[model samples]
Target: MSQLVIQDLHVSIGDKPVVKSVSLTIKQGEVHAVMGPNGTGKSTLAKAIAGHPDYTITQGDVLLDGRSLLAMEPDERARAGLFLAFQYPSEIPGVSIANFIRAALQARLGESAELDATGYYKKLYEKMDLLKIDRKFTSRSVNDGFSGGEKKRCEILQLAMLDPKFALMDETDSGLDIDALRVVADGVNKLRTGQLGILLITHYQRLLNYIVPDFVHVMHEGHIVRSGDKSLALELEAKGYAWLKKELVHA
Candidate 1:
């Protein structure tokens, strides 16, 4: 099974240090949720691992099945089975969802290998049906004038179609309403059948209610200060980050 291993990771945006000394090993079939207050570097960690050009990895390494991800470009990382679901899905006007995803799937195939169209659409429709999305959505421009829920659902659609070994989901529930949150969560849960490892980054515990995490990690400032099971998220919901801060002070 493929796994993502992060070791002593340190990230910087320009001269400002963000993620500091964070490490995690996510094996397939596991869901690890990273929780923290704003500015604690949860998003930075995800972006850095995804090879976002803005963030620099000053120290440490992120590995996929023992290969360093830092050596690969963003597209290379995607093709290597590492996927990032952005907090904000970009608007690609005039590009139909079908064409965009088909292009991505095609790129994964080498120059010599051509994607079969009939097979691609068949798989795409099957995924859309599984997510209970209307088949007509395939013709719409990607996230162009889409509602907040629609944008998030689109991200989930891409996730479903790509079927990456490891997914770094950065604040997926950020702008979602309760109903949309459930729908997106249900789609993700359906895909979690021991073939993928997910790192779900969010600020609220509500997202955890539907997509229960196997491990819960709390980030303070720049490093992970605490980690536990699902109950830890409930605890965070009950006692906020300030409470964790107080505990850290006493520790």
Candidate 2:
């Protein structure tokens, strides 16, 4: 089983400690939600796990299965089946969506093998169709001049094509309308399987309503303060963060 284990993780950006001893475990077929208020270092935690250079891991370890991911480079981490769908996907001016995804898939293949272009396109088209993406979108530049919903959908499309063991999705519902959010949630629900684990990071409970998580963790001041089933999300939504703050203070 593919599993991601983060143990007592401490991350910093320069001298500022952003993630303070945050630990969580996600196994295949489980959907884990990390919800918190802004500036709580939620995004920092995701970037640290993805091996982003700006954030430094000062202590603790991140493991994929039994292997230590801390020792691996960013590219190596990706090739090892870890994927991060960014909250704000970058725009690739010159690269077509098809070419970019193809390059990523090719990188996974060793030098001895080459991807069959015909088969690759067929598969890409199939996934695109499943996501309700237009056939013409394959030739468009990645996230260039696309709407907010389109960018989020593109992220989901990449996840479907790459088929990673673990996915770190940060604020996927950001900037999306109700209809768009539903579409994205449908894609995510369809992609969930026994071989895939997802870490969904978001600040809102609306997304959780659509893509009901198996575990919901409330992060306060960089650590998980509470964890429960999907009901926790609804409670947070109704009561707001102030109630959580009060509970933490009283605890």
Candidate 3:
């Protein structure tokens, strides 16, 4: 089974520490949700694992499929089967969605193999149809002039076509209304097969309502202060973080 292991992770920007001693393990077919207030390093942890240069990993290791990923460059890590869905999807001004994804798949094939255009578009349109994305989206620039919901849907579309072993979705429900959230969540749910494990990071419990997680962890001050099954998310939703903080302080 594919696995992503995060062990004693400590991250920082310059000298200011953010993620402190956070540890977790996600296996294929499991969905783990990481919840916390802002500035608690949720995004930092995701970026560091995905090899973003800005967030320095002062300590700890992130392993994928039992191999250390710390030494690999970001693109190398991606080609090795890790996918990170950014909180803020960037706009590729001139690249169409079809060409962008095709390039990514071609990279995975290395220099010796030729890309099959017919097979590629067949799969692309299949994924778009599954995700309820319009076929015309293929010709549009990646995330250019898309609404917040459209951007999130585009992210899922990429995820579907790439079919990574593990997906780190950061705040996927951000800026999405109820309808868009359901659509994005439905697309994600369809993608959750035994070959795919997910680490979903979000601040609000409402997102959890659509994409139910196998496990829920509450992050506080850069550490996961609480963890449990899906019911834990319901508790967090009912009581809120303020109650959790008070309980932790008194405990």
Candidate 4:
């Protein structure tokens, strides 16, 4: 099984340090959730692992299946089987959804490799159907006029199409209503398999209600302060992060 390992990671943006000495590991078939209040660097951790240029890794190493990912570019990381679903997906006004995803698939091929358009569309249609997305969506501009729910579903469609070994989802439930949340959550649940691992980052515990992560980690000031089973999430939901802060203070 493939493995993603983060070791003593410290990340900074320009002069400000956001993530401080964080470490975690995700093996295929596991779903790990990272929850924290605002400004805790949860999103920063996700972006840094995905190799966003704005976030610098001052110390520590990120590895995939025993290979170092620190030197690779963002595209390189994707090709190595890492996927990051953004909180806000960009609007590609001129690009059709089919063309965008097809181009991404094409990049994963060898220099001389050719993509089979017929088979590609067949698989694409299947994934769209599985996610309950209409077939006409492929003709529309990527997320250009999509509703918040549609946008999140589009991200899930990309995740299904790309079939990455590990996925880092950043605040995927943001701005989604109950129905949208359930649809997105169901799509995610269907996508989870022995071949894929996921790191879900969010500020609230509601997302966990749908996805039910295998492990729950609490992040504070760039460090994962506490970790436990699904019950920890409920506990955190019952009592706010203030409870954890108080516990930490008294210890």
User: Where's the lowest-lDDT run of ten residues in candidate 3?
Assistant: 189-198
Model 2 per-residue lDDT tens digits across residues 1-251: 77999999999999999889988999999999999999898899999999999999999999999899998899899999899999999999989999999999999997889998999999999998888889998799999999999999999999999999999999999999999999999999989867889999999999999999999999988888999999999999999999999999999
Q: State, as a TM-score between 0 and 1, how close model 2 is to the true structure.
A: 0.98
Question: Where in model 1 is the C-alpha error above 4 Å?
Answer: none
Cα error, residue 32 of model 4, in Å, equals 0.1
Q: If scored against the real structure, what TM-score would every candidate get?
A: 0.99, 0.98, 0.98, 0.98
Query: Could you give candidate 4's per-residue lDDT for residues 1-251 as a string of tens digits?
Result: 79999999999999899999999999998999999899999999999999999999999999999999999999999999999998999999999999999999999996799899999999999998898889988899999989999999999999999999999999999999999999999999999877899999999999999999999999998899999999999999999999999998998
The global C-alpha lDDT for each of the candidates, from Candidate 1 onward, is 0.95, 0.93, 0.93, 0.95
lDDT of 4 at 151: 90
At residue 186, candidate 1 shows an lDDT of 97
Q: For model 3, how does the per-residue alpha-carbon lDDT over 1-251 read when each residue is reduced to its tens digit?
A: 88999999999999999999999999999999999888888999999999999989999899998899999999999998899999999999999999999999999999999899999999998898888889998899999999999899889999999989889999999999999999999999999876799999999999998899999998988899999998998898889889988998999
Clashing pairs in 2: none
lDDT for model 3, please: 0.93
Alpha-carbon error at 103 in model 2, in Å?
Answer: 0.4
> Model 1: per-residue lDDT, tens digit, 7-76?
9999999999999999999999999999999999999999999999999999999999999999899999
- As a whole number from 0 to 100, the lDDT of residue 217 in candidate 4 is 95
Off by over 4 Å in 2: none
Q: Tell me which residue pairs clash in candidate 4.
A: none
